[model samples]
Target: MNLTQKAMLGVSAVAMATALAGCGQTTTYPRTAPPTDSQCRDWEWDSKNGVYRCDDSSSSYYRNYYYGNSYYSSRSALQKSSSYSAYKSSITSKTSSGFGKGSSIGGG
Candidate 1:
């Protein structure tokens, strides 16, 4: 190829690579310990009704578990957090990695 044509091809290749680098990227908010709350309750037997219940504690447990181990498309994406502490902690603990990006995480 001619010198001019080769230079153009190199530049185009670099531009293409840069454009696709962030594609398919995902940010991981790994599973972390649930926040401690004294209000949370445990299951209790209702002998009169013959059914076990504890103010929907079971529902909250599963919700927290699943929400804690969630992922986002990018670091800037919005997320639903259980509490301010969890949100703040995740800010520093989250990790992001993807194809075409360097191994150094959070490098941007």
Candidate 2:
């Protein structure tokens, strides 16, 4: 190719590389969704605190709780309360008992 054509190709390649690199390094935030009934069923529940106890077998910081049925990782009282409220709200909304015609006492 001629000099001008070669130079244009080089610039275009660099621009494309930079754009791809930026996309590769983009940060992603962790997303939490309301837990499903099936997920919660197997979970050991802490009635007093209303937190599900699950084994964090994959986490080095949480491996200690994995034995003999996992317990909810301990959290500050405020955090636990907030989590409990969010869990309750999600369940209430999804279950027929909350606002639908189904009996309020039964599970969704």
Candidate 3:
């Protein structure tokens, strides 16, 4: 094309390249380790069978694996835990790339 048009195309190509060059970064922090033994006390209480029914020596940390099922060490810890996922994740995302917008190609 003409000189001006050529320069514009070059500039546009540069701009587009710069824009698309942005990194597609992805990071994932795997679920943290389960509560440790030092974080335990005794065990939790069960309404029907009472506490320490799983293992008498089982600490609070181990008791959670049984009837009590207290995942976290303490109340505040449960609230503060980042990996304490209560429900299944039902979320989703979509990424769309195109010349500009989604439109019919080579049409009237």
- Kindly list the per-residue Cα lDDT of model 3 for residues 4-107, writing each as its tens digit: 99999999877565445433312222332333335455444433322222233544445443222445434445435444332111110111233322212321
Best-to-worst TM-score order: 1, 2, 3
- Give the C-alpha miss distance for residue 23 in model 3, angstroms: 3.7
Screening candidate 3 with a backbone cut-off below 3 angstroms (N, C-alpha, C), the clashing residue pairs are: none
Model 1, position 85: C-alpha lDDT score: 43
| lDDT by residue (tens digit), candidate 1, 1-108 | 999999999997776675465454444333334434433344433332222233344544321222223422222331333453465455433433433453333334
lDDT of 2 by residue, 1-108 (tens): 999999999987776555444432322222343234332333343443444444344444331211123333454542445454575566544532322222332312
Global lDDT of model 1: 0.41
| Predicted structure 3: lDDT | 0.37
Model 2 global lDDT (CA atoms, 0 to 1): 0.41
The best candidate in terms of TM-score = 1
Candidate 1 has a TM-score of: 0.27
* Better structure of 2 and 3 per TM-score: 2
Error at 95, model 2, angstroms: 39
Candidate 2 Cα deviation (angstroms), residue 103? 49
